[model samples]
Target chain A: MGRPLINTLRIALHLLIIRPLLRLLFGVNVVGRENLDGVDRFIMAANHNSHLDIFLLLSALPPGKTAKTHPVAARDYFEKPAWLFGIVQFLLRPIWVDRNNSGLAAIKEMQRRLDDGCSIIIFPEGTRGQAGELQDFRGGVGLIARQNPDIPVVPVYLEGPERAFPKDAAFPLPLWNHITIGPPQLIRGKSREITSALYRHLKTLADEEQAYRQRRQPEPHRPFVAAVIGIDGSGKSTLSRRVIGCFKGESCFVGDGLELFTNGEPHDAQPLTINEVRKWMGRQAKSAKNLARYKMRKLAELLLRDRLLSEVERWYRPDHIFMDGSPLLNMTAWAMLFHEEFFNAEVCSKALDILSGKDDRLKKDPIFEQFPELKALRKLNLNHLHLPDAVIFLDVDPEVSMQRIASRGEAVQAHENTEKLTKLRAAYHLVCDVLEQSRPVCRLSGDKSLEQLTQEAAAFIKKVGSGVDETD
Target chain B: MLDAEPSIYSLIVLVLLSVAQAVSLVSKGRLATPASLPVLWGLFLALAVSEWISFIAALWILAIISFCALREYLSLVDIRLEDRWGILFSYFSIPFMFYLIQIDWYGFFIVAIPVYAFLLMPVCVALGGRSRGIVFSVGALDFGLFFYVSCMGHLCYLAFFSERIAMLMIATVAAADLIHRALRNRPRALRVPLQVVVACVLFTGLAEWSAIPLNHSFALGIIIPLLVCLGRFTLKQIEDDLGIRADRLQPGRGRTIDALKSYLFIAPIVFHYLRWFLKWGAL
Candidate 1:
């Protein structure tokens, strides 16, 4: 009778004073409350990071449920002097355990408590993580969980507690904290399997909490752009559409003239007429002066396109910009069509110098004078050019790309010839080298199914956006 | 009634065994293989203490020893979950068996575990279900009851002998174990003969020194050593069947299986001495 009165008073003190005080001071945010909707009694297995983790978890629970839960604490630490023991017992009602000895006595006591309708909160790592990382769960959790197969094991991940009060700290610092509750995992197998399942479940909750934290924190105001560069038949437009779908209305695609004119629909670019390309080739073959004129006109057009795209990027201030067929890749293909050895370092340096406006030869040429827009584009360089923050380079074999293009029933372009495509494929490597100097480039195999490629691209974008790789 | 005077012969045997263990520890850096030392100490302590205590005290001490040995046995064997209650019951029966010895109820003590526990444990297990491994569980529990409880119950029967002869019986068993330990590594054909000869000579010599009559000494010589040899052989076979290794070299660090076998072997030889003492009083 006396014990019940004391316990009830303790419960009232915890519910009325301690929980509210901790929450008010710490600004505790709890996510995944729906995971605990139907659960009344369960073993809450969590990562051990700080002394305050248990208190934070208790605060997250409803006031009525506190009386039926017990935390399993080490006997060596909790059962010291009379005053400390009374305080620990009143606040937590811990099941004291000796870790050095055989665990049979502790196990029997825990089983008895469970039979009496008390749920348990166990730190499966058995000790606090001194470095603020999760440790592997000990096997005792599995042993107990297996013995009571009917009880649901709810995995909870606690963040910010380690920063608030780390292993040897005397007092907690003021910090905003979070507790993410994951769905219950009911597993039956060997002890190893049970431990593994618990670890993986808790790890997922940690990842989710981390992602939520990143979403809440403010990011720098820089527009992120990703370009999809590949051969015409390498499914670049298909992958671009899928990448756009991954953004889910958070971004816009600045497509080429064909995709823009089609209002974001899939359509083949208007193929270059063979008679026009033959006439141009005949003019080049007639005299060197005609060839020089055609080359200068082509360079001027590329410079104008780069300047216009830069303006489009600034207009979409913070939203991600994904370009479908950029002028940079088209210029590389054009260069490859005329030069057989298009990948030579000398040829690459000359192209980079002309594109970056560092070459005095381009300034002295009459083409810039003929078009004043070309003079305005001289500010475009390798550094300021609208290259992607990261490139998702979809690489496919030439034969496969050609087969896909042939099946599309669209007219072939001047550069879609087998001989030109072989050179263009090699030339895409040099373009990637130039792009690598500016931003991150991720090469993905273009031969995968559409669903596989989308998932991969979505994962890559999420990783980049969150600024932390969850898989690691 | 058993005499209460401290047996000088028992004291002398204890001193001898202690000195031998000390020498072995010094020379070989161990008393015996790590798996045999606990059994050796258990036998030494039981014999050494029972020689000085009252009959009831001696019975209680032996009862506790038998209970611990039974626990060791049950831990090594695979008993079903349902049979745990029966094992607890078997554990409780140890005190009752020794209680019968304390009250001098010899008739009931002899048959209590063998007849009653053997039949009742299977019933306890069967009530759970006729589930998987029923036969194996029943057989293993019965085997544990027979060896650990019934056979070890004979230690309490030693209350019938005078303290001197009772202590002498324990000493002879210890000597037999020592002899087996010494010659365990010899070729099989040579090892048995050597153990038989050495154990016979040692026990006979000790019995004569303890001033037993010649015929009883001769009987003690032959029967005690043969029982020790048989006990060692049975333990080896069981250890092999259970896949327990006995190759550890640290003293006092033995497995449960070795402790079980040692108690099983020594208890019956002590029972035989009781039989002899009852048939012919105090030689």
Candidate 2:
């Protein structure tokens, strides 16, 4: 009835009703909570992975503050039983509106609540991601947020909810899931403009989740078989196809499946640029202890080779076939997760064994050294995936690369504050510099258009593919 | 009607008291919560309840009411602080002149507040160094105070002059208040049509019996509802010109359209003419 009373009831409902359920079932883990800040109004535009997403979000909230905040719930489910609905409205005070309807009423109600300085949590995906895959998102949250530009919209990823409540099931199953909240990004502008903004926000959250998953997996001592790196908007696909085109042998698209280690349809598997890899590498320390041990894991080779073994039976493992974006670039940079001295000789021997993979010819190719700082490059002479005769590094500025990617029509998320798309572009440029100086690392100028550059690079690759006589 | 021997002291006191009331009003700004029309009617009833003191009390408070009503009019019109003295004489003083008649001072009171105050205010404002065609200041405030003090003052004089005066004022006041209420929120269903019929019959009967002449005035009252309806643009006009809508012009109450028109058009003119005629005959 009154502000204080409503606040008290909200706290009680969360403590007595919601928290216990989350602890009992999901054993919910919340991460990156230091990023949370109190603000007047905003939508928590989280990736909806499970029925557990609601509870996961509840757990992520600092105690007692959910009083003024509401998670938007679909009316069809949250309003079914009168008694349950009363309890939910009493505790959560969720802004329940008909999901089947055009969401105009909910938008109006949300606008009213926002005017009163209230916050709402919106699941941007609008439904659960099935089979551990991030689904394409809907744009209602975008529209409402666009209508009210002052509201900050935060992206939250609730990983592992389908395991808890799979689709078409009446009840939930027991499982553990982590709730990851990305930093808040506000939605501004109208209609298509806002929807594009929401789409970009969702992609960033998905990227953060992918990066988080990569850090959590066990480290292997396997050699760096392949490393794919590119800037935020750089056309990594064309470069990837050209590099793969060089090797006159069977090739399969390894993409990010090897990176994520999940057996599902891969979405947006572009190569990680230097800075993007560094960003992921920056997160590795949070992933585990003995960071050296974590870096050496053969997760990529095993996943890639296995996919090749099982899915592409027609092609035998070629003597020295080139792969595209397979071995994510910048291992020596990722090794920075452990301090420099720790990347020593014994580490190289273990890494070499992993790289050679029990093949004699694969062990003999010259190690590619892209940067002087990368100590592991000295040891990479021992190749795991039949070391390439040479390593070709396409040196593209992140800005040009990003522009190129935009030209290719990929839905890349633009950084919120910058008008010139400089932040993401700058990130791309940093990666290009890191990949600039390696052994046999041919630096291809990346400023040209994707087609022209791809054709020129293809010709260069063909020349290199045939062994030139020492006299000529 | 012009007399030179009244010491002009009477003129000065009426002028000074009107000025003081203006200063008090300008300092008070607009009413935060408007006094309800019912409360205003009750105040009028207090004046009417006693015959001997009624005229004296009405005259005593008439300057205050004119001050108040004109203050409401100026605020509703958004007159500036610099113009208060001019408004006091031009707008409020005219009403006080009529109020002076309760004590048998009529010759100077009849013309000075309305005619001379109207001519002098704009010149005084122009002398003070700002001119924005603020004739509306003189006009609106003049209209407001004249109706309350001059016209209503004459209406009050009728009762003291003749026994018929008391009954007529009571009937007019009661009828006006009732008509406002009936138009605002008539009882649900067909009662509205029935109430309208009764209002029409009662109003027609009362108009014919009243001592004041009303051919042009009552005819204007008849067309007022049509004007108010057509004057839907008044809301925009008020906002454009005055920066505030007049009380009855705000965008609500379709049924009360007729009632507001009557309050705005008829009541003031009838009362003023009555008070003037009663004093003219030395009743």
Candidate 3:
């Protein structure tokens, strides 16, 4: 069929067939579909809610036009599997945008499609909000609407989606989602007045959504011992602060547990010394036999680092510790802490003896006070604390993470620091594994807004505190 | 005819390329592959013990290099399995192409791959009776052979210029690469392939002046490919480490082509060096 027939079918399918089904199935209600002229080429800007929102909006549209409506999804998520991705692409033909990093290409593609008479459903919130209420919108939508004044920007509100299928939840609840489409607001001016006008229009539309009204004073989500995992430099530090802020508390970025202890006063008692050992190891390194020896030694050192941290954490107890490292590293450290005798005690004693001969008491003791928070040492039953109160994973890619770290200057440069980051990243899986055994842990996508994540954390705390047992 | 003076620089270039090829192979984990073993053997003969070995050994090594290089090229490109016979004939003819050029079979050398190999490939493919416009596939395959192997066979000609000149020619290509990079680094210059070509041409002349007598050719080959290798490395870095969309033109293509060209120039040079070693500088 030609474009006209396709558009006609799209509208017919949505208005006649699909809308009725969604209304029956999801109790779907459309508020302002009439405000937006069905024929005009404009962006249907909406708040992200459910994955099903794409269909919900498509069904709400007048038939024939539904075919022309394209929703933007993150490329990394959409481009994951060829079979799934291909099927989604074939059916929806979504305008895939990389949400992890703000790339100009995605914006250009969206603008190009808009120019071509196709409508894109973009969530200005950038991602789905945990609370049913309106999340703060990014300026990207503003830029697009401002850039193309002719494309009437229609604000859409999706109500009750967070309750139906909140962030990180797998299945949608039976809660009816009321969809509201606001009147098309055009950006005609260049001054601050225009920008303010656009923001006001968006806020009004967001406020008018039935879903926002349903979620009255949505409580902020929270959990204890939130593990923030990401590559180095992806505002893990900043995100941790927001998480702490969500609890109205603060966090201290304890430097790596392994590095802290080894470099401490009783450093002579360090289980593995790579530099001194390298001299002896380097001799046979050129030969194949040394490769095996070196690998074994590396494993031993890893085990040793874990043990040392456990021993050091014997003195301190924290209300909530913000580990700079990932959950996986924390677990590994815990596992090592529990495994006591694998260490060479004779070597440890000799090292300690060497330290004791030093002039200063701090020098002689060589105790690495900065230790790993071995989960084994915690008195609280992990089963009771259960799934991480929250997990704010700074989910940026390694390159972006490195760039952020490099910009932070020289405080982070520790020996084999990169290798440690890699190891800690792997350790995050341990936390995930624990999560699988319990309930759905609240995860604040580090890739998203600090405000949104903190708000999510606050909501989580309220849920847990109120004894809303959602652990399934 | 004036005898070309023997230059030590050409031998050094050959050794360096062989070393580089070895390192590249190891990095890619290709050195452990069964097919790559023959290439390693060839490299050893051509590079390590050429002084003690006969010139014919070097010829065998060149033949092996051509064989492996062709194999690697064919594997990476998605040529259909239907064109197997054509691929086989193309590979079989590489050694013969080099051999014909080696013996100065001028007339055959000129038309051997272009006219005969191209003509025979389709005839063979038609015999399989899958000839649903197999001509285009065969034609592309023949062109690939001519470009990758036949042009590469020019290494035999380098022996005539003395090992040093052949090595220097390879180095000039490297210098051209470095010049291309340095010149292309204008704060706002468009990073296009055409720009790279322009830079290479300009830098070749400069490298000839500045790098001569001090392993100029060797240095040029080294610098150019080093830049190309770095380009490929960056492309890989972007692909692996960075969350960026990689362009369609990968650095591997640049590295492979640049490497093939440098090796093509070196093969004949090393072949001639073997000859000089064999007959006390008398061909």
Candidate 4:
């Protein structure tokens, strides 16, 4: 009577209190809850990672099932500090089995639970392994399965829960995790057969999760590039931020154009300094000396940016990097602007031709005859720069672009009026003709809802990672 | 006074969304319709709100939709190495079309693409320094410009007729198209005919409630869905010509063209029909 009443209170607490908090803190997205429907009493076997998995598994099960779901744990670990055992009783109500014994107690406990209409959740690895890597399964779960061969064993895979609540963590941190539940299987074979089958099941789930994460999540082993390029006020930064929110990993949001000139300044400073930079640009047409000085400053800035990016690549080793704008796309498009700035028009045209891969004499870099610094910088090459694998170009009308820029409280440059934005928008499209020769460019409307734009950008990145065409 | 309650429409939409999300989760992302249904509605609601504010905002948005659709169309058709300038001019004409709209130059906006851009795009393609496949590339670019830019551009032009009429046209077409996509594989459920009826009823009801000054709205409500059906058919054929698959849209399928093609076939006729009839909102 005492034990049943205690179990009832434990179930109520786990269902009403603990589950909601775990869900809020972890953001545990349970995808296959319907698989648990019509399942009466069975063992849910998952790869062991952290204590969070226990709650996540309970959350995925039917609310009524949490009352009788018995998660199997070792006696030597849980019962040692009686206070932890007390907490475990309320949270998991786990069934304790002796690790040193031959396995009769586990089989008996599972049999008893099955007979009493209770389902079992057994960590076949017997203990938590390394964070992401799956450990070998023991035959203890197989022994329980053999004792009750008619009962089904459902396989599960937990993704990134260890990042929140590992064994050695000081406390649980709020993190997003995913749970994948596979179909149930009833093994009618020897203990070794059942164990290997269970291993294969978990392994398949792990492989599928890994492949999914490789494309959708970050993988430092396979770095790729994505860019959100548009005219001013086309919400390039907003789109980048949404994509970042969708998937948190080792990602770097890159910059280009005048943004690359910022030597480790805060991101919001770009709009603040634009007016001063535009003044310098307006004066360059009247003074060749100013033009030369600007060209040298530009070269030094590019070199410094390139060196910094190289060091970041070597040290930080991001899995993926997406830029708000592409350096190649913007610089090439702005070549027309460079034409009026005491710069040679032929070289500007040739640069556009070369960047577009039309004029194939990129290595012969004596085109900027009067600007030797720019020419020498081009010859040396930018070691860290590469073309984006995926491009999201948000096309907006210049009038609307001006409206958006004015509404935002950022400092507006001299060239931010309706006419210049119009010209700049045309230049972007003109240069995009060259970009389209290479990769799939996803051009979206800035007028779309942020949700739609973010989803499009995220899908574009996944397509790029898989090396598939955007249409596919 | 009695406290007011939320409408049943919100509850219905919420239930539909929950069912869609449940199905999407159960399928493990194989079927995209159940997953993307809510997003489609969200985009439509946003369009409905933004287009009501400023006609120029509507014009710019129309340009964006046309630009993306044209990009998808160009992606489907083959282009030679020399088609860069041709494609650039093709994309360039979209902004010009909307710019004409911004300045309320309906005559130039209407004739800009078909007359001048049609003749000039071939020249730009020839400027790629090669004549081989120039004709085909130019032909392809012109075809896309007509369907995506010219036809889709007429949507904002509907604003020149009447914002109410324009809004009604958009709501009907969007509703019917979404209903069609939602029920494409649901053979047991009423499909296109059901969508047509719902959209017609929806337009007629709204037109009656808003007290539209025109006599032809009731007639338009019935006519618009049929034109949308024809548009869907036309887009399907174009997709076929481009060798796009006939399968239902999967999760990874390109939704850019799929969402916009529903408007492409009917937009021009709606604009012109309303313009010829009401002669309203024209500058």
lDDT of 3 by residue, A305-337 (tens): 333323333322223434444333333322322
Better of 3 and 4 by TM-score: 4
Q: List the DockQ of the predictions in order.
A: 0.00, 0.00, 0.00, 0.01
TM-score of candidate 2 versus the correct structure, residues matched by position: 0.29
Residue lDDT tens for model 1, A1-472: 6989987888888788878877654546677767877787788998888888888888888777788889888888776788998888878988878988887887888888899988899999998975446788888789889998888898999876775566765455444466878888788888788989999998877775444121212323455667777776888777877776666333555543313223333334333333244335434433334434655455544444455456544443425657665555556545665654434645555455555445656556544453333355564543234445667777888888889888988655445656667677777776777667655666778778989998887778767755622322
| Model 1: pairs clashing at backbone N, Cα or C within 3 Å | none
TM-score of chain B of 3: 0.57
What TM-score should be assigned to candidate 1?
0.39
User: How well is each residue in B155-174 modelled by candidate 1, as lDDT tens digits?
Assistant: 55654455555566565565
Candidate 1, CAPRI quality class derived from DockQ: incorrect
Q: How close is every model to the real structure, measured as TM-score? A: 0.39, 0.29, 0.29, 0.35
Model 3 C-alpha lDDT per residue in residues B5-96, reported as the tens digit of each score: 33344356456656766776777745432222333334434533333444455555666566645543443333433555666677678878
Candidate 4 Cα deviation (angstroms), residue B96: 41
- Where is model 3 chain B poorest over a 10-residue stretch in terms of lDDT? B242-251
- As a whole number from 0 to 100, the lDDT of residue A19 in candidate 3 is 71
- The fnat of each candidate, in order, is 0.00, 0.00, 0.00, 0.00
Worst 10 residues of 2 chain B by lDDT: B250-259
Please provide, for model 2 over A1-472, each residue's C-alpha lDDT reduced to its tens digit, 9 standing for 90 to 100: 5988877766886787778876653456666676676755667877776566776787777774566678888888867689988877776777877877888888888888888877788876676656456666676776787777777777777665654555654455333455767777765677567667766766776675444121212322121222333433445555655555444443433443222111222223333343244335434432435424444443333334433422222233222333443332333223323343444433443343344353344333332232232334335432343333344455556556556656856444322123333433333233334333332344556677667766665565556444432312
